[model samples]
Target: MPSSSGRPNNNLLRALSAQDYELIRPHVRCETKAAGELLYRPGDHVGSAYFPCGPSLVSYEVTDGDGRNVETVLVGREGAVGGIVSLGFLPAYCLIVVKFDGPFVRVPIVNIQSAKDRSPSFKNMFARYADCLMAQMFQSTACNAIHSIEQRTAKWIAAAMDRTGENLVPLTHDQLAAMLGVGRSYTSRVLQAFRQEGILTTRRGALIVDDPDKLRLRACRCNEAVKEHFDIVLRGVYPEPDDAAVA
Candidate 1:
């Protein structure tokens, strides 16, 4: 009995043609989730795909043997999490957690499959999104291997800011360290350096980006590389920050 009204704020859903969107419109429902809420864990069957709206964000994290959860990719309003191109109720491979508290559009996997089966364009669009997502994962792997902690930190902040359209990131030093798969001290040093450069400031549980352009200058090209792929594969689907929000 979940109700949905008005146009979806998600970039992926907004990119769909009127005809294609209507196919899944009736089946989609709206829900709000709090930050740090776990939507899916490893081995859980993914029955629905959640499309974040506005500044909502989700992340895929994998736990290592040492019990550290390392983030792989962050999905915001630009795309979706869970069962994008999968068939039936497939088991999730990683932990999917909500990073920002906001509204999300939920569509049953069956409805998505039905829409894709009926429309080649719908299938192609989702398929392209899957490709773009994979490219992001690949670029993140490369960045982790090649970039310095400082560069990675700046890149992560920039990417988050772009999707949320906000200069303030609601993340703690511990959380950022976990996402980077490094010790807190490493991330702290990077953040301290950024603070010294007047690029950002840290609060009790958040970091505020003071100068986005300066932060971008310190970041590696991994974000840009992934964004370029997204542009080529799904133009206008990637989220861009509003000028006033970032400024």
Candidate 2:
């Protein structure tokens, strides 16, 4: 069984051996994060690292001169929210916000650095994870730029479902617009079309995917591209045990 107390309920943590788990166990702290919560603002000081225990989505956003912000990347259970610290940057313009309610384990940055200094293997794992996240971010940029709204939405739904192990995503249309960098009206239209096609079931403030296979088929090539990279590069990070939860 997984150990109790200051620990991360993440793939990386599960992958660790007894000795490796013990190295960083003492410094972890749990936190409850709700939907729409701002995990970190543009210039907030980096104090700790969050490893999501349940499902919590993180969006990277930038504000334009007109005060309108655009999302650049979405992070969920597959990885940690703060990877910029690895590059030695303290405050970045990218905003980290939670889109799903969950419990997360936070380890102080200082403690993480101390563990890195003491363990070469732990450092190697983090370095690899950082690289994987960068690759995913680049893929997301291309997908948003070239993919159709319907295709992109399908991809988003598929990714979220994979992470949460739940079909129901409790998000409002406005939130979806912010995520896709599209207008509210457009998001509503796209969702309406999907519902008509029996691809998704939308309620007052949530979307339930009724047909995942159809959704995948409708998604653009960008979805498959990012997933392929995640599979090849991240490998053991997301385990596929032939179970229905991720299947």
Best candidate per lDDT, number? 1
**What does the lDDT read for residue 171 in candidate 2?**
83
Model 1 root-mean-square deviation: 2.8
> Each candidate's TM vs. the true structure?
0.95, 0.89
After superposition on all CA atoms, what RMSD does each candidate show versus the true structure?
2.8, 3.0
lDDT of 1 by residue, 44-111 (tens): 98989999887888999999998889999999888999999676678999999998888899999999
Clashes of 2: 0
User: How high a TM-score does candidate 1 get?
Assistant: 0.95
lDDT of 2 by residue, 57-166 (tens): 66777777777767776666566776423744376556777778777777777777777778887777777677777777788888887888888888887777766667
CA lDDT of each prediction against the hidden true structure: 0.89, 0.71
Candidate 2, which segments miss by more than 4 Å at Cα?
Answer: 1-8, 83-89, 239-247
| Residue 80 in candidate 2, Cα distance off native in Å | 0.6
